[model samples]
Target: MVTGGTGVSGETAETGAGGGEALATLHRVFGYDAFRGEQEAIIEHVVAGGDALVLMPTGGGKSLCYQIPALVRPGTGVVVSPLIALMQDQVDALRALGVRAGFINSTLDFDERRTVEAEFLAGELDLLYLAPERLRVEATLDLLSRGKISLFAIDEAHCVSQWGHDFRPDYLALSLLGERWPDVPRIALTATATRATHEEITHRLNLPDARHFVASFDRPNIQYRIVPKADPRKQLLAFLRDEHAGDAGIVYCLSRNSVERTAEFLNTNGVRAVPYHAGLDGSVRADHQSRFLREEGLVVVATIAFGMGIDKPDVRFVAHLDLPKSIEGYYQETGRAGRDGLPSTAWMAYGLNDVVQQRKLIQSGEGDEAFRRRAGAHLDSMLALCETVRCRRGQLLAYFGQEPPAEGCGNCDTCLSTPETWDGTVAAQKVLSTVVRLQRERGQKFGAVQIVDILLGKRTAKVIQFDHDQLSVFGIGADLTEADWRGVIRQLLAQSLLAVEGEYGTLVLTEASGTVLRREREVPLRKEPKRPTASRSGSSGSGSGRGGKSKAPAVELPAHLVPAFEALRAWRAEQAKEQGVPAYVIFHDATLREIVTQSPATVRDLGTISGVGEKKLATYGEGVLAALHARTPPSGPAPEESPESPENPESPQSPESDWPEPPDEPGPEDWD
Candidate 1:
């Protein structure tokens, strides 16, 4: 089984002999001046043959933990990844950096697999990526046994936990890595995991004594904003038109049908978009994912099945049209944005229907009582986050048992909008009184909209059929609009004073409702404003993520330096196209912005930029300098007219004429 070959590239012969050598590789290969937060410590520990459980954020340079150690240690690194896309991306990125890396997955033909296996066994590869399921095969184990492995890296280690949002049953067998390769140090990494999920990962992976490095779960570059759902399609279009026109983003919906509809809707409205879900054919899903990754300024409307280890670094936004199952899921999904360390938006629109559907999923799911209870608790915590009136970052970090900084994160919707809360005691009494009248007096159970109608005295066919106008509480709430009453109901749901029961999503009074009915407890709810609050944080200074102002964020670049930035981006886009890669692979927008600001004239000055590593500098350094030197003064943005110019086809039309009114309110059937 042992096959031999020479180094694929001359750079493969380079090795980090510890101390200064590791630092040399850090700059020369990975293109960084120094290791980020606990990276150096982790690399040192793993190189010295110690186990680690690293909990770093999405763009936190987690690969360096195992990669540096792999290069420093004596043999090839074995990485277990869950998704084939993830493996391909990492291997491609590694190969681009001049590291000898290969992957074995179903996408490869038998001969391709055999070739990679041969190279790995020949000690020609510094790192080999495999799916955890591959480790279950005896032949793969035998192959690993034949080659000396520098370390065992378990990517997305949280997948080992049954309670994790993205759990993979195949990961259960990964514990054998420690049992079989006892001498090899192992490192597990994940972007989002709670204290329980963390412990579950460590225990399930059998790394009981591994050194744990829990990086701060904060992603300061992503601005989190959750808005109340009105007309979801309109809300989304407005968000795109106002803030993220011509930017790439992921729009997560709850169902495949919605994904298709949303993508089609976006396309019809001048924005390019694609739909992705598990229901699509294999080729279709792959094609959509490929376009989403390879093309710029395209939105991908998909289900939760889309993003896991997707390496596109310039995703400008992550919009959720439905509520995620839990906070961990939300964190991971939103974390996909701003991976390039530039400002991005995490925007969502949630409503009572999202609450009902989530609860229904948990209740009818295949699980025991304890499992259901835990799932309910997780949903409750997620609901708490949605309704949080304080700093979202504080609540989010606190869920993971980390304290927020004292000043509070000024970037979230709550901090930026400063929503005002008003006493809802009387409102709660009115709503609770109506529920009591409907069930106890009239022997009728109704959902939120019907209840709103009865209270508003709309006297619809159902109200008249039930003769609900005869009741004492009927028409008492006529002063408030239907929207106002819905807000009251949502707040009550958040307060646990009201519960929706049965498969019908009927409004029901909880024990807490009795206290509110009797005036024993005071209820306060957020006053739903008629207009959306404009966002004030992040780099863009236009309207709020929910959309208000018409003008785009003013571009702040000085007129003279704009040409340099454009030239660099033009060159980067050309390189990316030539290599069939995403443009950020050459250099991110943030790096280019920094380059423009500094106006680096030489390869040495370019090397000093944050993202310009040694290999990248050597490869593109002169080309970048040439692009900068070619920049001419006073051209006004671009020569062929800005894509955002008045004549641009991608520009938004009249907002009112372009979008349909908010779709009719969700009916009871919609909840199912």
Candidate 2:
């Protein structure tokens, strides 16, 4: 059926779009009030038979991007997913939404797989999820050839990037989608991808001229921070105690051993935590993840593999036990937090070895030498980002080709606590001079530690044996610590002023270094390390995302509703548990806060809060209102309320002790 209507908001509603009226159908069938962002438009274009490559964030409601169109269109939507858990999750979620969905994978025995495949071929299922490996098979391809696939979606599409941190060889074979289903509109979606990775995805997925939907990388709900990695366990404990003392979160580490040790340390410190990595037994890994998702106030120490397909939106914090290799990876990992759109924290405690470890990992990988060199160079750039003396958020966004607005975010460590820097143009020159001298005398001899030792004139067996170490500049910079020199090298590398030269991949300076040597550029470098190094390469937090508190005092609503609000929260958590969904999916804290404030006695009153959709109010209003009436007496009078102050100021405001102090002046915080 053709649909006709002017656009809802000043935008044009182009006609002849694919799955015309899919949005209207979705509203009627799925009970959704409206589409979020470009969802409706993307669905319309797909109905119009155009391709799409969506770069939506994880919690941005991606499933509806294709689901609605699939249901309204003539045939099934083929969603290619890599994991069995993801397939089952989506299929179940769709079915619960009143849409028939099915998946065919190795987990199902032959009979069940055949039954599902047959159902898909018969158009009984509106959506079909398949693995890329399965899709590559002749039988699956033959089955797909007979069906009319309205649209094809490649989830986790960033896996196509060989340059990306998460690369799947099976994903490379998916490029054949163009050859197989040329007529069907295709959409590839991933929560993470930079310009380089994006290009790779486009090329490999053969999604040329596909519309690109890039959401703002800034997750305002997430408080971004990086603490100095000193006595990491203690710092983590302090952070947890101060902020997220009891909340659900993920702690990421770089290695399997670190994952185990950090999880153990955190558990001993009274944080219920589990370790996850590729090294763990399959069943154990699944159990750890299940516990993390189902249980509240649990933390999981893991590598990159754990949280990719997860939907735990209410995570109060996302902490990295080790520095990530790139800002894109870092951003994506942190995006896991505050997905329920409440305030959350993204923190990292990192030091110098994180840089060396990532560099070594890149260098040791089996790939083209030139490629490894590029990877190592990219890793150094990321290290500079982590240790940056400027606004971390600004530097991060700049790397992704988006300039953060000029105003400071006031959330990151740099913005909150500015660091001092010195003009190291001379130091840069000296370092370059040493590297050139070393290259002239011998080939790429050793790693950074060795080179620094030589420059500082540390008398060693190798230096004494190579008596020609009578170099003029040797020992001249002995006053500076090795860490200080390493910082200089990292900065120069980040600025593209240095290069790791030769097939052996030794660090050297590029032509840009000559300008610094000639004093054409003055580099303002850090005088000393501001952040401390964790004794171990990785450390898990005792509790939460301790990015520090905002100077703004906690907003005061009313104390009379404590029992009611707590009851409501408890019920919401239970509902989420029963449904096997994230608690935020049921009700966000913000909405609940409004519920307590508004004390909506009826469904009509619940509609006043901003995020309360008609369906949500219809489904949850009665229960929430019942919780509010749990029959508990009100407690003491509530503390006075104040407007939220800027978070960048001195420190977060603590609530008052006495009920009524001088109106203008806040009294001191009572130690009691």
> Best candidate, TM-score-wise?
1
Which regions of candidate 1 deviate over 4 angstroms? 1-19, 532-556, 632-672
Residue-level lDDT of model 2, residues 1-672, one tens digit each, is 001011000011112223337656654444333555667777777777888888766556566677767777789989888776556655654554456789988889989998997898788988898988997689989999988788898988998898877788899998788787888888888876778788999999888879987755655556677654545556665566467667788888766766777789888988889988877788998888778766778999888878777765557788886778777788889888766555677878765445544555565556899887777666766777765778777776777777785876766667766777888888888888777777676653454555677778888887767652587767867877776776776666656676654334467767777788777888777655444443232223222233343211122234454556677778988987888865555655545665676567677776654345445667776887788767445544544433432323211111111001111121122000
Q: All candidates: CA RMSD in angstroms? A: 7.5, 10.7
Worst 10 contiguous positions by lDDT, candidate 2: 1-10
CA displacement after TM-score superposition, residue 507 of candidate 1 (Å) = 1.3
CA lDDT of every candidate: 0.76, 0.66
Query: TM-score of predicted model 2?
Result: 0.77
Q: What is the Å distance of residue 483 in model 1 from its true position?
A: 1.1
Per-candidate TM-score against the hidden true structure: 0.89, 0.77
